[model samples]
Target: MPYASLSEYNFFEGELKNLQPVYKVIPYDINSSLFTDYAIKKRFIWMPKDVQANYTTDREVPVFPIGTVLIKNFYYDNTIPNNTTYIIETRLMIKKADGWAFANYVWNDEQTEALLSTQRETIRMSWNQNGTAITTNYKTPSTIDCATCHTINNVYTPIGVKPQNLNKMYTYNDGTKNQLSKWIEEDYLDTKPTTINSTVDWADASQSLELRVRSYLDINCAHCHSTGTSCDYTPMELSFSQSTVPENLGICREPIDFVTGDQQYIVSGQDIQGSLMHFRMNTNIQSEMMPPVGRTIVHQEGVELIEEWINSVETTCP
Candidate 1:
């Protein structure tokens, strides 16, 4: 349940568990999150009896009413003997009278509460995943930085709440439930579209490589790369859809300012080293990376997948 007033309670204190039940826990097929080494969990909450979100077709994100709230928690397992999960921060999106308001609460040392913070913090974090010791600074996005990608068409919209992204099934305490269907039954969402276009599960090797790579790019880069954004200064249109042009997809396209490898090809087929797309994605440098911020390390698996797709599609770029 959502708090009646944005000022009513201290969200930084982990008040969600005591106030009301969870509205919904929505997971994405592929999520574009802030660069961190930990697993993330997301949930939706709304003021009781508030208007439900409206559905749409053709790859549009769902529209939520005033008083709606979205919550996301970033956490990781403690490497100590008990291996307890520790939450680093919790982000909230509340639909106020003015529109969506963004806030972040940083968890305290005790883990019992998090405090509202306006500035970004770098938490030196370490974890053992499959017995591999991994460590990194978990960067928390400042409240202002939250709007950088979330602001679409001049509005602070939730990026991943689209029909296509939320079309998957989830396992819950009661049972397995299809998110969209459950949303409808709970009256948390309205107007089911006849057709919901779901993107590819990028890690699934059985799916089409083209669809997988394009879908990955859509979430990871399309927000800034779409028309009218600063990235649009370049010719690339990374949004994955039927109408997207081949050149926009970086087929034989060339970077405007910087040289790609030893050649000019933005995506030199079968040549990952020569492709600017691969080069930028594989880098963590502040100025040269495709995503200028929010990530400190390259997503090696994602780069490999895109490289495989590029290798299979074309032999050369002219």
Candidate 2:
């Protein structure tokens, strides 16, 4: 049975507002992350004592033991005069004997405690972003919505926590160390391979255009687009490993379904105007946006990145 309140788990120490993890609940972060209307996220993982997760593959999620809990908290920093912060939600995925289970906790206005809720909600919020006041109605997804993107081959699975995404260094209370190494140190993970095909930070412009775009799609679209998932029927495979093939990226391939206008190919090389992928990313229309549920507004920076990448493609479809 799920706990009625998040506080019942005792995952945090002292004041819950501070988000300090208790003893064995280890904090972590991924390299490339999905965008959720620019909400800041804090992630942590806790597992049963003496039981460590087994490594499957660099690109796949580790095999966690039963009773493991993956926690993620979403919030926004208000840039107003008071500089107040508002925590929106905390989502937990617990590994059970059967499979993984979802538990979403909606924070209260007092910022004191969050209660488990399966109901969908819209939170109208405003915040300052780079000197601009931005307002949005952030949608909190229900458990059903959570399963939509998380299910693979009819089984609920995690998107992040893969070795490729967690191979980078992170600063802990002790000092800075590689996250995978930190996991080993805490006895939360077993088996550290010599080589890891790591994922790069998508927002880092210093990386190659291909690397940045591939990393972005791997995190944002691959969860549903890869094999045995939601959009597997589509020809495009956006996972970093599969995306290496031009055909998988849909460079010159025709889209299975028409999206609108003269967008003929899923990704029309060197033609942003004729690319369906670019069209979907650049729009905020409910019926047209890619990843449909995550954001209400367009990811302008991500769109720009895709546009730049599309323009750099040298191949032309026959």
Candidate 3:
């Protein structure tokens, strides 16, 4: 049955505005996450009692049982005079016998309730970040938009629930522990490998530039760029496992569809200016930006990270 209001599901305890997860609903975070115009995201997974998700390969999504719900809420903080927080939307992906179903709930201005909505909507808001006032027209994705990215080979699937992304340590309400281990303890996952090939946190400068860049693209672009997806016709395969190969990252590969400026290769080694990937990441233009729909503004830090990685590459594309 479709829910008219978000509170109908009883996913959160106490006030709905608090956004706390209920006992069976476990909170989790990915190592490298998709950027959505700087909106902070909170993710949770809930499964039926005694049902556990089966672990697939590190790179593949976990096989979740039916009655599993992936919940994500998007919000912003430090808005207005008193550092008020405003939640924009909450997206849910529920696993059913047929397939995964997408639901989007838009929060009301009062911050009390969120109602199920299918139509596309935009909220104009401003927030303080690092003492700077930033404003944006935050876009709440329509159901069609959700389907566009979540669909893979005609099947709707969850993207970030893979072992590689969820293998990191999380500070839970009770205590800090590895997410996979916590899941195992909670009986949310059947079992995980002793040594999981985990993805690096893209924002961590201590990690290698290449790993950070690969992690960034893996979360942000790999969904569409992988085989059987929207941008699969393109040479690049941005998934972390495949991005280790230069060819899969489009190194020296010519852009087939379009070019920005004098861009020669999808990724020109040591030449950030000539790299199509860099240009696309740096732009906000709908036609030029990579993963264009989810973000309205350029992710400055992400672009800088890509630029540094490109400059570090020793191989110069001919």
Candidate 4:
């Protein structure tokens, strides 16, 4: 079911009926979607007939054979139990012989179609979210911008497709079931570990605030912060599985790029006002903001969550 080009399939139309049954619709725990954007859905499809993906018992991400296709759709919804939604964009990740290739399609004004574009563009959109009038410069990233976050260790890889992130339960048409087990049962995954470590479900109130915050940072920032990546020179390790030690997690640490504001970069045991992490997360200004791309609006909810977490802890670099 692989297409020679992204335009070959009319996925933005009603073609989902054909693809949904063939592809494995997957979900992640933390939900790394941009703020102001409601509900992001993902599906993974393998092109090779009768070839299932090999599962990893070593905790590394399972590598799919060439021709694997990963699809993600973004939408903006207006009200409770939203009856109407505006399609924002759709992104596709294809595994080629050389490596993974990326493409992004911006949905049309009619919402019935999406067009593949080579240049990044912004679509000014408006919606009534939670009874509040909201407007955003919905960003459609260029082909090159797609590589910035996907590339790891000089290789393009799919983030959040790892076992730990995908080890939770997912609700299908049949019923709710563990995603790993479902994948194995459906023959999408060859095999999986008997016992798998799981990342936190950020929206679940039962989990600790610390766990939720860490999970958020792991999926959202670890791409560049991990060893050998763009931010490798820094000491911070935002990986979810990393040790909870202060130094490893950047508590009470000084800014790496000499970003001296009125407060310390990450005041280990301080409130939002003095925490540099809080400052950076609160703004979208280049050189001051994190995740430098894919977002034109600040994620207020995420910023508030991190702010609360930072204020709850007390740590010192010394």
Q: Candidate 1, residues 118-194: lDDT per residue as tens digits?
A: 78899877777778666777788887678787777777877666777677786655678777777787677886776
**lDDT for model 2, on a 0 to 1 scale?**
0.90
Off by over 4 Å in 2: 79-81
TM-score attained by model 1: 0.86
Tell me the TM-score of each prediction against the true structure: 0.86, 0.98, 0.97, 0.88
Backbone clashes in model 3, listed as residue pairs: none
> Model 1, residue 162: what's the lDDT?
73
Tell me the lDDT of model 4 at 209: 86
What TM-score should be assigned to candidate 3?
0.97
The true-versus-predicted C-alpha distance at residue 240 of model 1, in Å, is 2.7
* Model 1: residue 10 alpha-carbon error in angstroms: 8.5
What candidate 4 gets wrong by more than 4 Å, as runs, is: 1-7, 10-39, 42-44, 57-59, 79-83
Question: What lDDT is obtained when candidate 4 is compared to the true structure?
Answer: 0.68
> Which model is ahead, 2 or 4, in terms of lDDT?
2
Point out the higher-scoring one by TM-score: 1 or 3: 3
User: Candidate 4 on 200-221: residue-level lDDT in tens?
Assistant: 7665668888778777787777
- lDDT of candidate 3? 0.89
Residue runs of model 3 more than 4 Å from their true location after superposition:
none
